[model samples]
Target: MLNYLGLPIAASEHAGEIDHMISLVHWLMLLMFVGWGLFFIYVLFRFRKGANPRADYVGAKGKLSKGTEIAIVVAEVVLLVGYAIPAWARRVQQFPAESEATVVRVIAEQFAWNIHYPGADGRFGRTDINRVSSENPIGLDRTDPDAKDDLTTINQLTLPVDRPVLVHLSSKDVIHSFGLFEMRVKQDAVPGLDMPVWFIPNRIGDYEIACSQLCGLGHYRMRGFINVKSEADYRAFLAEEAKFLTQ
Candidate 1:
């Protein structure tokens, strides 16, 4: 159904549910437009000057218009309570356990994305703002034992397909939005806040990540890529990155 509407490809497990909700809302909106428009045209023709030369002081009394308004209100109520609420609850409240999922941290800045991996030990290293510089974007404490194996990358995210992945998202200077359309995942990266987004990529491919928020003069160039690879390939990529770490 989404393909017919020219929507983006569904690359993750949650894409189908999001597409379904969007289709429902659009279909209802279209139905309302065509249905109410025809009715309005009919009313205008029925009360034209040729039909009623003398105008009535009081408006014509009828229950049809009132009933139509009531129906619209009920439809919106059902869409909110039935569809929107459940979808949000399922995504935010039903996150998988960190131990059972591959965890990564995405730190957004003015014009780039910083991807951090906890390496083999599964523990993030310490980061300090005072140490931030052109060479060290995230200010990693290489002396810290936990940070010795941590890997950092710019503008690229690599994950294994068919596994639950959690991203701890944040921004360095201003607000940014991490938008992965194919995965149907979008979350704001706010400064001083750790927001989490989880997803399972079912397809192995490369997808684009756009900054949905306008940060500054360089917002237009804030682009990233997500590489969904097979489990073996993902492990190989991790090993390769680990070897390149300066620590």
Candidate 2:
């Protein structure tokens, strides 16, 4: 079950329904190759000099090979409408909400990622590009009173295990990508629009996050870590982050 990339077969979120869709695509391609191969082999064997020694003069005279044509059309319809359409629809649907869900915001820059978690208030701080400076990673709007309480962290993100988490992603300069290779989730973080992604971590572990788009010379260095911890550990991490913001 090794993949073409020589990677071991996935058995976790890395191999979720998305991976299954990829497998189905490969299988369909293999079927087409086999069918075409057999057709060529049959032609070579049946029409060789030793067998007929002459081309069929009526092969192209509107012979109406209706059965083969109909079968090809049917196979195409099944693959498109039956398999591909449903899988795409499911992925585009919004993630389900649970009673206990966490919200996190991710902002992408040229060569870094900034993560923001709302404090106990559950409201994102007001942000203004005009007030942007080196100190304010998220460019909080000082004039807006709501910006006073937002907590911001850089380079690292943390999540609680088993809780439904929603991530709102955006890019500051150019188009970027928020992708978790292990989680099997990736989406474009466009500049003007905020893209939302959601997932629940079933296990406790650290995962890698990368910007899949070519943003700048340092695009390859735009990387971060996501630590999914137990409920207690997640609270502790949030407390520590709050301390940094208050100071």
Candidate 3:
């Protein structure tokens, strides 16, 4: 269903549910279109001038039209309450445990994404706006012991396959959207708000991250990459980053 629907390759385990929801909505729309089109055609032929030269004083009325209208309303209500709301609730409200999932902070700026890892200590180092510089965009307090072990990368995110990854998303300036098509994850990165998105990538590959919202003049360049790797490769990446941090 996914491949034939023109959707991107969904690498995340939970993406199938998203695709199902999309399919359901499209099917509903198609059904409505066909039903209405046929009704219009029938009306044009039934009320043709040749059949009735003089217009009837009373308009044609029947239970079928009322029933169709009621049915459409019921279907819409069911779709909203039973399907769409539940799907959104699961994505936003039902978050996985931080201890069980790999967590990272994704900070957005104009035309760039800053990826911050908590290192071995599993703690984000202190950041100060006053210390902000061209080289230190996040303004990490390097004097702090925790800051010494923290790892930061530019537009690069790495995670292990078969495990949930929680991304704490925020922005420094205006609002930006973080969209990963394959994982079916899209969330707004608003300034002064730390939103979270969790997903489990079942396949090992690189996926594109696009900003669905137009934030600035360079919004087209606001892109990132997610690299889902095997467990061994994930560990190796950690080890290599740790060495770089220590040096």
Pairing residues by index, what is the TM-score of model 1? 0.94
**Candidate 3 or 2, higher TM-score:** 3
User: Model 1, 119-152: lDDT tens per residue?
Assistant: 8999999999988888889988888899999999
- Higher-lDDT candidate among 2 and 3? 3
TM-scores for every predicted model:
0.94, 0.79, 0.93
- lDDT at 142 for candidate 1? 85
Expressed as tens digits, the lDDT of each residue in 1-247 for candidate 2 is 4554443334234245666666666776788789879979987887888888676677633345566667668877887788678756665585656346788899999888899877767777788787778888778864565555667777788889877788889989999999777666789999988888877676687777899999899999999988889999998987887776567
Writing each residue's lDDT as its tens digit, candidate 3 over 49-69 gives 999999898865789878888
Where does model 1 exceed 4 Å of error? 57-63
Provide the RMSD of all predictions against the true structure, rounded to 1 decimal: 1.8, 3.8, 1.9
* Alpha-carbon lDDT, every model: 0.93, 0.77, 0.89
lDDT of 2: 0.77
Q: How many residue pairs clash in each candidate?
A: 0, 0, 0
Better of 1 and 3 by lDDT: 1
**Backbone clash pairs in model 1 (N, Cα, C under 3 Å; residues 3+ apart or in different chains), count:** 0
